[model samples]
Every structure is written in structure tokens, then in C-alpha cells.
Target: MAQAPSTRLAENAETRKTRLRLWLNILRTARTVENALREEMRVSYDQTLPRFEILAMLERSESGLRMSALSEQLLVSNGNVTGIVERLVQDGLVERLPVPGDKRATLVRLTHKGEAVFAEMADVHERWVNDLLRAVPPETAQPLIDALTTVRRQIQQD
Candidate 1:
């Protein structure tokens, strides 16, 4: 016996609903984790996630990066980046230097103080992440990582 077209359509619709629910759940979980991390950073380091992000990126780049590049890497707008960089400069944690041969551009880099502060924050951040995921079995770690990686690649391709 062959299935009717209406039955097939119903099944497809059900599958789509289930997929949408799963995607929503994934986003909720991610947001919860981020919130927890943000709280920890605020209480312990007196810093916001975006500020920490900028320092982290600058720390990784020896020669620093252009303001536009930092904005791109952080997936934020240039205006937002400018505000953060200005605050960081005022705090003496970062410096903005005019790009050689580019009068209209500036490179942002972490100062020595920024590096030391980031090092401390990085260590605590790692610990917080490990604690957050400690409930999961060690055996499931690699599979979960691989699945998320695949999901990221597929979505980016789209």
C-alpha cells in the first residue's frame, strides 16, 4: 500500500517542528551558558564579556590588529568597537597606534597591564567553563564537539 500525499506532508511538517524545537533549545542553552560566564566575569574581574573579548584578541595578536579587523573578528560593528577601545585606552589596558602608512587607520594592542589582567581572567574563565560542563561524561566530549563543529560549518555554508 502507498502512503497518501496528505500523510506524507503531515509527517514532513512534524519533522520540521521537531527540528525547530531542537534549534531553539540549543540557542537557549547557549544563552544560559553565556549569562553564567558573564556573571562570573563581572563579579570576579569587574569586566564585561565584550571587554574581555577585545583584550583576549589583542593578546593573541603580537603586532595587534586594525580597529576594523577587531570589529570583524568580534562580529560587532565598528562603532561598538570604537567605544570599547576608547574605554580600554582610558584604563591603560590598551593603546591605539596610528597604522604605518595609513593615516586614517589605527592598530589596537594590549598593554602590559592588559596582558597580565587577561592572563588572570583567562585562567578563571577556563576553570568556569570546565566546571559548567563537568556534569557531562568525558566519553561524550569529543562527539559533542564534533557535532557542534559540523553544525557550525553547515550553517556558515548556508
Candidate 2:
């Protein structure tokens, strides 16, 4: 037997409300984290988190990543990523190189300066995470990370 339509509608509405609440709370926390990172970057390093993220991503990638790939990884629109990449290119933190086999394609690689910046940023980034997480005991923090990862994986799977 099929379930009634109204029951399904009510369930969906409740789920949507619950999801919105969760997202709102998560956004609030993220904003706080961003502000803290921004302060650290500006006051201590004279760099922004986005610049750090781009350099860090390049540092971890062997040959580097394509603009499209970087957009996906950064979860930003292609145009936005392009603009950031252009700025970094001008700053000499990154350079775009021809994809030898693909004339139409290009890959962005970190320069020596970018790598140095990334190394410095990484140390401060780790300390930021430690300071943020230290407020909660490891037992509590570990479970939170586990739970959040589970939820993120489920959402991504969908």
C-alpha cells in the first residue's frame, strides 16, 4: 500500500526546516572561524585565507591543477577562481603554463615564492586549528569531527 501524500509532504517540510536550522548554525560557526583566520592572516602574516588556500592547494598537487579543477576544489564559480588566479599570477605566486598536449588547456603552478608562503601559512593554519579545537576536549572534538564527516559524506553521496 502507498503512503498518503500529505504525510510525505509534512515529513519533507519538517526535514527542510531541520536542515535549514543546521545550516544556519554551521554558517555562524564558519563565519566566526573565517573572522579569526582573517585576523591572523592580516595581523600576523599580511595574507588572506583565500590566497593561502590557493597556494596550499598548489603545494599539495604535484604538477598543479587546472583552473576548472581548482574551481571545483575551491567550491567557487569558475569566473571567481579565474580572477583570483590572475591576481596571484600578477603577484608572482602562481604561473599558468601550457598543457603541452592540449593547446586549449592550461595548468596553474605555484612559484618558489608561493611555496614559501604556503609553508609559512601552513604553520599558522595548524596553530589556528589547534587553538580553535583546544577549547573542546579531544574526546568531544573527535566525536564532533566524526559526526560531521559522516554527515558531509552522506550529503556528498546524495
Candidate 3:
């Protein structure tokens, strides 16, 4: 039997079409960028994108990341982050130290190996971003970043 074509009610068609198009565009852009990042990470550092991101987060932290902080930053569960951290520690890329003020909390900091890997990772990450956005006029970059930040803040609001 032949499948019927997509049907839309006269009144709802345009609005639904606009929404569908927007979502499709978002998905496409996200998938493309994510794939590029993952490929870059795999080839350049022998790491996955999530692992690279986790390392970058720690690199930017002045005091280092707590397990809870890492969880939040990666949007993953504590169990997940714990395993990742353990692997990193075993690789001599990260150090788990006792948190001074909080006896119960442990701090996760990059070790010398971690710093070296992350510094190279950071360089590659920046280059990837720049290359991807090179077609976008430089003047639009700041406003684009601001817009995305605003969206993130709004989504994260209590």
C-alpha cells in the first residue's frame, strides 16, 4: 500500500511548519558541530569529546573541580564522573586531593600530565571553534556569543 503524504490542518500548518524547521535546523547544527569536535578530539588527543570537555572545565577552574562540580559541569551523574575521574587519575592526568575546608569533599585537579594534555586540547578546541565560525563575520561573533549565553542563563534559571 502507498503511504499517505503528510497532512496539516489549514490553520495550523504555517505555525507548525515554522517550528519544525527551527528544530530541524538546531538539530543539524548541533550534530555537525558535535561530530566535528568529537573527531578532532579523537584524532588529536585520543580522547572523547566529553572527556576533553571535563578536562577543559577543570583547567579553567582556579581551585579545581569538586566531584559535584564536575557532575554539574558535565551534566552527568556522580557515578559517571567518578569513573571518568578514576580513569584520568590512573592515567596520571589528574590528582584527587582532600578539600581543606570540607572534610567530606574531595578536589579534582589536573596533574602535570593533565595540564600538558589540556593545554594542547585547549589549543585544538579554540582552533576548531575559530575554523567553524570563520565564515561568520567577526563583528557578529560577540553578539552571537552573548545571545547564546543569554539563552543558557534563561534555560538554567530557577
Candidate 3, residues 30-128, lDDT tens digits: the string is 799899888988887788887887788888986798999999878899999998889899989889999888998889999989999889878879999
Give the per-residue lDDT digits (tens) of candidate 1, residues 1-158.
Answer: 87779978899999999989989988998898899999999999888999999999999999998999999999999999999999999999999999989999999999999999999999999999899888779899899889989999999999
List candidate 3 segments past 4 Å from native: 1-20, 101-103
Distance from true location, Cα of 18 in model 3, Å: 3.2
Q: Which stretches in model 2 have alpha-carbon errors above 4 Å?
A: 1-22
> Which residue window of length 10 is worst by lDDT in model 3?
3-12
Q: Single out the weakest 10-residue window by summed lDDT for candidate 2.
A: 129-138
lDDT of 3 at 65: 85
TM-score of model number 3? 0.80
Per model, state how many residue pairs clash.
0, 0, 0
Winner on lDDT (2 vs 3) = 2
- Candidate 3 at residue 15, lDDT? 83
C-alpha RMSD of each candidate structure in angstroms: 2.6, 3.5, 6.3
